[model samples]
Target: MADQPTPDTSPATGSVPEARIVIENCAVATVDAQDTEYARGHVVVAGARIESVGAGPAPAGLRGVTRRIDGSGHLVTPGLVNSHHHFYQWITRGLATDHNLFDWLVALYPTWARIDESMVRAAARGSLAMMARGGVTTAMDHHYVYPRGSGDLSGAVIGAAAELGVRFTLARGSMDLGTSDGGLPPDFAVETRDGALAATEATVDAHHDPAPDAMTQVAVAPCSPFSVSTGLLRDAAELARRKGVRLHTHGSETVEEEAFCHERFGMGPTDYLASTGWLGEDVWMAHCVHMNDADIAAFARTGTGVAHCPSSNARLAAGIARVPDMLAAGVPVGLGVDGTASNEAGELHTELRNALLVNRLGPHRESALTARQALRLGTHGGARVLGRAADTGSLEPGKLADLVLWRLDTLAHSTIEDPVAALVLGAPAPVTLSLVGGQPVVEDGRLLRVDERAVAAEARDAARLLARRAADA
Candidate 1:
């Protein structure tokens, strides 16, 4: 067995200074711009940004000035980025596990309506904590279900991310079409179109940060075609563009969704989005499993991105997305775990592995997505989808030091085979350490920024209370 790497001994002194963090003796899989990999390498992290990378130890003159981490038998990569999620759904896992997309929504909508600000906050914290341990440094969450007169759901998520120390993009999603309006969601869960747009604007004005190293951002997202009016989608896209923020939403997630688009709008979901001006570089659609060749070409031409949620698609029996086709067409693609209710687990590493397996199941001539490609989907691909590629994707000089270290000596990854393949083909394990912007959120397989046990307990109580309310109704 490969000897275990010595634990990171660099003391957590005051905030890391502008000096570099020399991670010596480790095999660096730096997913640099040219897809370069330096086997026995070192990374120089200067304060919150990566300063430089080389194939060997630091030179004698530069050795003693900064903190040193001995990385003996580990694999270092960019921290995973989750392109789409619903953090509020963490408390609703297993509620409708056996149901399909529509049935699952019908069953869980009432429980979600019972959620308050505290529930949202607790669930967000718990989800972030879980993903952090699993090496997700940045995540975008779509919180669309707002009960009648419910306080700002986006605020709760923002507060949670602040407390938990993860980069977050809180997409203020809205559902304006209730059952009375021929939508799947009930009346209480849908917000008025005017109120939704106003709240979106308020969130953006107060929270959306456009800076290069922004820790938080806000996006405008009208829930979905079947749950929102055409006017709201177009207006949201326009509002997002005007605010200089991005747009996000669910699109063509299931056959039911495609059928609804065909029956209601007389076009496919992608065409409907195109007509509404929702197809562009600043927009990313989640769960685009039903898009055809034309849709893929349209996305490439317009520079639209896709958030491919393989696990959720499989769990909900929504068909596999044409990820290979999208990649071939030059459409940016990223990984999303979707929601805890559908995926049950929010581990970005597991999602990355699943994406590899699902893509390989397609035609033989189609290139099998490799572990390196899967890792890129979780890192660079996601950064591009979230409009942050200029800052956070690869481990180049001046990029934020958002990174993860996975121990390679574990039982699940014992063999001395390809390190990249070990990550995708072996059993999943929690990251030993995860850093976002040079700050450690998970160290030694534990969350360093929050109380994990207490958060889990609170989420359990909240879930029970909400489940009771749903049962009573």
Candidate 2:
């Protein structure tokens, strides 16, 4: 018999071309328009884009790549998008755990005023890593606290995001009214109206990216009605519109805010916003917990979005938002983790779970919110609020490949019958891998871009120093 031909073992001898990544034998949850779920599927990624997705083997005609990722026994979905956050507050978590929103602000304002560029950058990096581990790929950070001569804290946050490789919408938040001016914040924590506007313009000019798939963008956010003058809100809105950016602010977060609006502006929160031309598709407000039917109608008609921070609300004893009613009213609603000092966590997945449970407390009949609905609020709905739905929030061709892969072998999900439902009902788990714009920033449940433990330690030291400085002041 003729000698059997030995199998070719050379590196380039095989005809089977390499794939950038082959997520094989995984359950794919494509949160697309049709809400399709692929069980035991494969995802082929090439150069930061998903080349193909289907069940079974790769097509024979496909060509070469470099890496491959086995995603068997994992659940893959579009990454969670956090619509609202204060990344700086990660340094103040647990400081005001028992206070309401108003009292909490009063207690923390002085400490927040002590933040420098380095401290703010450390906090931003820590927050981003925490959120990424929780499966958040895109986040909108409302960083409004700019102490006098702190040296551009907003730019520090942008730099941190760039280093972390997470898509960031840095809302240039401003507060113009100090306690002397009948605002909630102290004088040191507030800026002059003109200074705030100038800073807003400078940040927008320097960092705002209007193009699709932008990693960083700037939104003009005048902190809130209680801490910002009417001129600031209106000017911020005008500036946002003029620059084609978005506007964000805290509105109707608590009953105290309603009273403040009534006493100062002689109108409800939503009405005050409308009177100042702040209601529009280009605007999204955080914590609309006390909005009424008229307010909801106005939001719907004006195409204004709302960021529902359920965990923060519950923690602060604030009433639940009329999320179901707001959804029924056709308002674009997204999930927000709010400030870490308020909610004590930056986990976007936990926010989605809380959002589902809180919405059920409403009087609406039928299912309050499906797991899929909750997931949408975290992904597509949040993308809509940040004005990036067309480029993110869904797994599709031409969109930025921002996504998370979660291991399903955890005890919480051991008996889950539906992987999608398990995501919302099961206990939260750290993301096994997280990607933004097709770049892997987190792999194997750890951040690949930064040393998280070191940053966390820095944050702890910074927080202690801030506390000491604030107390001395």
Candidate 3:
């Protein structure tokens, strides 16, 4: 772990030895401005940024690169970006799978209220490790369920990310509207409006890094309209803007939510969001499933982003988001595996696959999304949503060398004519190599910084303890 690669190893202008990392002879999907691809290519990663990407072996005059990786027979793509997740929900998998979004929250809010520091640390580590193995280099987690006794659970998740060596974005999520306040969340799972805003600001001041190569960033994210007050939403937006961090929350996830907003605020979800000053470039909402054409146009005009969680929406019977229409309308859309309770796995591959299939299911089959487009939603689009587009989205030169090498030569993928297509169409494959900031976090399909088995065992213990406590309560 001490020797894990970091980007700051070399000076910006000095004639230091370029610890150039060369991955030779592989199929490259750059996913850059041009959506470039190479049937057979090589990528040179020096320090933390990509120095060059081209066909064949490393170019001439490239020296001081002692590390060499055999990328042969693999499909190389920018590491998947998970724009939205709930790391603490890793312990809640297989629960309330048959319930819709509202019922699912009703069934699990009490259980989530049991989360503490230990539970969050174990769960976050397990979830982050799972994402790392599946080629996700960057992840954004929205964790708002803060019990009274729970102390700094968000920090615990950030600690787990540090241990895993993956880039992390923590959405300092809050829920202030409890069931007593005409909201969906239980009282124990909600916070006071003032308290929520204070904690959000404190978290940002303490952890929000504005550096170009920051491994961790913070965003102010109130849980959702159904679980938070309008005042909190406005305040959170103001605080995030003042602190120069992004804003995130759930929106238009279900028709029930729309009805709630209409009955409570005399408008739809989008209208409520706009009234609260949350409709802008700095805001990215999760699950715009019930959005109308006008809402889509508003999102486009405002440059607001969306995190499309396909598997969780399907599992919860939440309506499919009009993603193709959103994309056509120029809404910046990204991929998210939501929470483990609904998705059953912290896997970006599931999100990518479901995003492609779900878009083609309804009347829009004639204009169905292609495999490449879905892949972009997981990679490039995710970066844009998370406000990390200038850094780690693609495999272009000068970008952070955060990428994945997948064994497309395996039996499951070998049958396809295109390797990229195989990745989108086939089952989720373990990454042979995964790098974040030029550090190989997953080499040969195994986590390097932490023991996966120990993490899983610890997580299981914590989850079992939580389940027992919830049952007794």
Best by lDDT: 3
RMSD of candidate 2 to the truth, in angstroms, is: 4.5
Q: Estimated TM-score per prediction?
A: 0.95, 0.94, 0.96
Every candidate's lDDT: 0.85, 0.85, 0.89
What's the TM for model 3?
Answer: 0.96
Inter-residue clash pairs, candidate 2: 18-65
Indicate the residue-level lDDT of 348 in model 3. Answer: 97
For residues 89-127, what per-residue lDDT tens digits would candidate 1 score against the true structure? 999998777888999998888788888888888889888
lDDT of 2 by residue, 177-235 (tens): 99899877779888999999998999999999888878999999999988998888888
Candidate 1 local distance difference test against the native:
0.85
Error of 1 at 80 (Å): 0.2
Candidate order by TM-score, highest to lowest? 3, 1, 2
Clashing pairs in 3: none
